[model samples]
Target chain A: MKNIVIGRYIPGNSFLYSLDPRTKILALLILMIGVFVIDHIMHMVYAIAIIFLVLLLGKISIKRIYLGLRPLLFLLIFTFTFQIIFNRHGELLFEETLYYSPVSIALAAAIGIFWFFTKRFIKFRLLYFLMTLLAIGTVLSLTLFPGTFATGRFAVYEEGLFMALFIMLRLIIIVTLSTMLTMTTKPTDLNLGLEQILAPLKILRINAEEIAMIISISLRYIPTLLDEANKIMLAQASRGVDFEEGKMKEKVVQIVSLLVPMFIISFKRSDDLANAMEARSFAPGRPRTRLHVLTWKRLDSCVLALSFLLLVTAILSRVLL
Target chain B: MAIKFERVSFQYTSMDNKGYLALADINLSINKTGEFITLIGETGSGKSTLAQHMNALLQPTEGRVHIFGITVDDKTKKQRKIKLNPIRKQVGLVFQFPEYQLFEETVEKDIMFGPKNFGVSTEEAAKRAEKMIEVVGLDASYLKRSPFNLSGGEKKRVSIAGILAMEPEILILDEPTSGLDPIGRNALLDVFYNIHTELDKTVIIITHDMNTVYEYAKRVMVMREGVLVYDGDPVALFSKSNIDRWNLDVPDILGLTRDLEAKFDYKFTEPPRSRKALFKALEGMLK
Candidate 1:
């Protein structure tokens, strides 16, 4: 539930905070391009440097970045494991013949059991999860058996490890960059910026304002829907859901017990919201007056120029370096 | 005691205000049976937070909460994951919009959800559902209807029945009768009161309705600014001079009692329960 902290804008009066959201969005886009354009892992130092500089300017804490990364930890680990196991590009760093003996299997089970039991007792849950992951990986790859048994070769290649870390780093950068954008920019301003940016789509007769409104409204409801969903979760939990502990089949049922209600609630809410909007004489795609209009200042242009320079540096590095 | 809060303080750190306390230093206890406790408060006064703590839906941020004698504290919860299924079973919490919790295709299956979740056999759960639908004053035929399609009141009753089907020893409801019309609210209150008396279950309701507090509650707890300002008999607590500071709406009966005391200069031993009772008390005072 805490992971869905998207659209949650942290208010600050820093330089990044004051810049036009359009500039920030453009900056985010260019920086993202830069991140992807940089093929070498070391070339990512430019993206990392700018991000850190943005972080310092924005007053966005490392803790917030850590929180942003937390929900993707499973994804990161899975990719790392997949790359380590499957990718066979570079020379093998290590090759081990592993056998799944009864004792080793029992040891794996014990590790799982130990993690399941001891996890609640541990305060640093992410570290504990990683520790458990490491333990399981070690048991899977390194365990040896004496008897003639079913065995497999576990090989760790240099390129695979490097690719895995690179991908993970790439993902972290993208997530952190987006997190920074959302964290710094208010949702309404972000929507206005989106509309402004999408204005060129008018050539195809696509209404940018409508699209922006849709995105804006959707962004607005994420927290509300999440709050409603959290309430429903607690309600279900009270009915003996044990959301964190149920079996696979029961968990599926439990999920339906959650999702259906959520679906119903969202529909009901949207209906009411639509009526409310209509009552307020809100017509989508209609030119609307704003209480606080977004303005692009000289500072915004400077920031955009900086982003352009970063992108050029990235592209130049790709060609020349 | 079914539930006890020993200096329980909860803070909602999810919000921007890091120092905002939802529940501050709450030390209270609910009996295992035969108590109708109404928790009254301003909006954001932590009544809902307090209610959630009763069933271990929320553990205290500070201090210990004993749910059916199982202590939930920083130390204990950190030591091991406490099995809360039994605790949840024994304490049914019907939330503000309990109807939203309903997800089953039919009312019967929806009501059976809680009991089945607690591992009651399907037959037994069905039986409990039947009994509880009746208990919540819903007809048996309504059980066949989709809970999603029912009127607001009916849906609420079905959701309540879902909890009641669990046969919790302690029932904690957060503003159970808030949105209903007078008759509907009265009927729902009557259903809860009957459950309180007949089944002899401890009933704790967090209600904004001071009338509900004055009418049904044996023990009334008033919270203001996350602090328990009052906890005592409904009549006695409402009569206190400092009750006004909480900015609470004076219950109609309490208002009448205060009026009678002011106008007639007669201090009644009990707060009149109804208009007729008020007249009777006035008649007695005149005599």
Candidate 2:
């Protein structure tokens, strides 16, 4: 149970792993901004291509990326359905009592485009060009197609298509950039980067050390909590607690039983951890030496520079073109 | 004065909402001065449950536990009202796999935790910690190193030192040598012996290993299904025939010695606790 979640971080000397955490974080921020600035299929295509190229260089497996996407499948489907039903601005391809709108079609297209780009980012093993092309196709399909089903209901397919493309491009860029950041950075380094970034809050008498401790504890416990949840589920299953056989309310009651035990165990572990920490003289305000130091190299600088250039170009294309 | 339990009964709550009686009515006492007392029982026999009661970590559902004539509940309430700092200062407990209790990044800080928590000054805590580190036979160089990084035996020793730093009068250890290899177990036994002989601290150990009880304990307590069935000298306890009825085995050395005495038709005046003692007894008989 403990080993299951911990095995996510593959140990390797890939370029992605070697890049500074701060650089990755900054690049992620820039990409998210660039995603919002994109207004056309061409720009969306370029953004997807860049993300794919980064994933290829990172050496992360496509299977692992797909696995990451498994958790978000429901959300993706919901977004697609919501967008398709609500879009009213597009031309009606079929007539029915319930007329589909151009707006709904554009929204569905946007969702599809975002999903495709996000999936590519998750499938980090795909060839750079292939992932980029898939991302472009997603954006184009979303932007050019309106979800209207009614015929002769004042159609404006070109406007709906362009709008859908624009929205899809934005979403694709955001998801790809965020996924890339997470896939490339270690949690520990990310924590250190957070500490460095939040250091300015020290002026308000807020202790950075305490905040860092909280972050570190949260990071450490998430995997632990998941492991505990898994065990509790297994224990309940062994005791004839069929979670799948129950109605919603019954399932909730069963879940409550599992959660109660999990919470109890977590609290006990926390108390033990506290005692252990105290015994080790881990008091607030004490200066401690770090074993692993974060260093920024030339590669980090180059990545940061390229990310900024992309952001500037994205903005220029939106404003000037 | 030392730890004593008077007619104590405890009931454990099971997952199915049923009560499992852990310890039946029992009376036991230990002196303040150094003495090794071993409690032996099978799994679910209340050996561990009984040990927890010694330090007031768990209160008896019935009867009373007295530490140096002060009832544990009385002390617990008083400590809660004012603080438990004093009671905790006197009775230190080293739990099973005590190394897991280590939370400090450095060994020195971990050792100082108990002392500091009890309101000892930083300087005094450090001094006590240094003494404890030596007492546990760990090098001073370990002071700066992380506790988690230490070997299993070393981690156990560090945990023991953490308890000792508080200067507890009575030390309760639950399965101290459990999960250790033979050599590690023997080395730990030596450490316990040193604590008993040199420090004069009252020590209570919970174990099921008959040989350990026979060899080391001045007094042996046998518990069966949470009932204190026998409390007497180790030699006399081993000689009893009804032991098998209680699902208990005599120590291997004692069994061999008893068989020899039966075959030879001459009584060995003293029952041997170890191979050396058995050899010495044989030499005397031959002479």
Candidate 3:
């Protein structure tokens, strides 16, 4: 349950924390665009380096950054695999064919056995399992599928492998960097910053304040809702709900038992919140006084200038090199 | 012993990675079935934390907890497959505001959910559900109604019925009458009383209501700031010289008894445990 780590803010005072919310929001946008603008491995390296530099300056724990990345690990693997499979540029890396001989069968069985046990025992089991899947896929293509690895026609392109790395690294850096933004920035400031940044959208009649309020309220209630949901789960567990020891169908039923109550609770909470908001006279679009007026300091400007420079460098590198 | 905690301490780790001790070196034993024990404390006094340990819901950070001889401690960690289902089945915990646990379409299904989860046959589960609904002073017809449709008090009763359907030997309720009116509170307390006396279950309750404590509790455990301050017969608990230091109000009847003693200088033996007891004793004295 703790794995739902998004929207969790850890209070800190660092360079990133001190930056104006608008500056932080803009920097995140530019950096995300820079990630996809990568054309060379060097560009990827530079992007990763900047991310690490920001993380270091923020004094955020690497373990927390890694924890933030945990939920995306599976999606990262999927994207990486799909990139390798679909991209067919550059020369072939390897080609092999194994006929149905006793030695080949024994080798396949041995690999399967190794994979099965390593998958169960290894610490980084998911990564090891992915490698095992790749190995088994290669072997199966060689023995079962004739036009692929079986006929020595199956090939993994070097460009495809490099591209996949670039994409995966790009994804991880973007997510980790954005998580840094959220982890350091208070939700109130985040909402205010977002409101400030989207002030221009008011020209088009969009209610930016209400949108910001929605985001802030949602962010604020995340931990509260999570805590409530956890309590409910425990209460149900005490009532003999063995969530871990159920069959798939029974597990679905158990999940319904949890999710339905959660839905009810969230709805009731929102209704109560709306009532409270109305009682407090929180009318939308009314001019409000700021407790902390966001003043753009010289450091905020310097950070913004540096990010823009990085963004330009990223684009120039994509174009020239 | 029904439940035993030996030097049990529980530490909760905050997001900042600092461990705060919630329960500290609590050594206690509940030995008998049909023994009504009430744990009374202010909020954050570790009353609920201690109650949770009784059902193995929260494990001790230091020392051990044994629920009906099922060891839950460092040794259970080594074994890795010590089934807690049996222990949990025997020790039913009805959480505060437990009505929130109800999610099934019908009250009967919600009530039977516990027994069914424990692998009881549907028929037997239904039977238990009907019986528990009656036990909680609800009609059997309530079995088919949506639990969501019930009033706050009725929802609480249904939720209690869900736990009672498990037919646990040791029943623990955390502030079971918290938000109820007087009548609702009495009705719920009656359900627990029946569970204790009639069904012969060892009932442990955590409450802040001193009146409820005096009325129902045979034995009372007092906790203050994670420490077990007092544990004994409720009558003995109230008579202690330092009872005022515990920061608990004396139950109303007992307060009246003391007031009567102060006014008349009567050395009354066998102080009343309930309003009825006090009234009967007062009539006897007048006659």
Every model's TM-score on chain B: 0.92, 0.88, 0.95
The TM-score between candidate 1 and the true structure equals: 0.82
Q: After superposition, which runs of candidate 3 have C-alpha atoms over 4 Å from their true positions?
A: A3-7, A61-64, A75-86, A91-106, A124-149, A153-156, B74-80
Query: Per-candidate DockQ versus the true complex?
Result: 0.57, 0.02, 0.64
Positional deviation of B77 in candidate 2, in angstroms?
Answer: 5.0
Candidate 1 RMSD to the correct structure: 4.5
Model 3 docking grade = medium
Give the range of the ten consecutive residues with the poorest summed lDDT in model 3 chain B: B73-82
lDDT per residue as tens, model 3, A49-84: 878887887898989888889888889989888878
Rate residue A263 of model 1 by lDDT. 95
| True-vs-predicted CA distance for residue A254, candidate 3, Å | 1.0
lDDT of 3 by residue, B76-113 (tens): 64466887767779899998885459899999999999
Residue lDDT tens for model 1, A260-287? 9999999989999999999999987777
Candidate 1 stretches greater than 4 Å from native: A3-8, A34-180, A313-321, B15-19, B75-81, B257-271, B279-287
What lDDT does candidate 1 reach at residue A271? 97
Model 1 chain A lDDT-worst window of ten: A140-149
- Scored by lDDT, model 3 comes in at 0.84
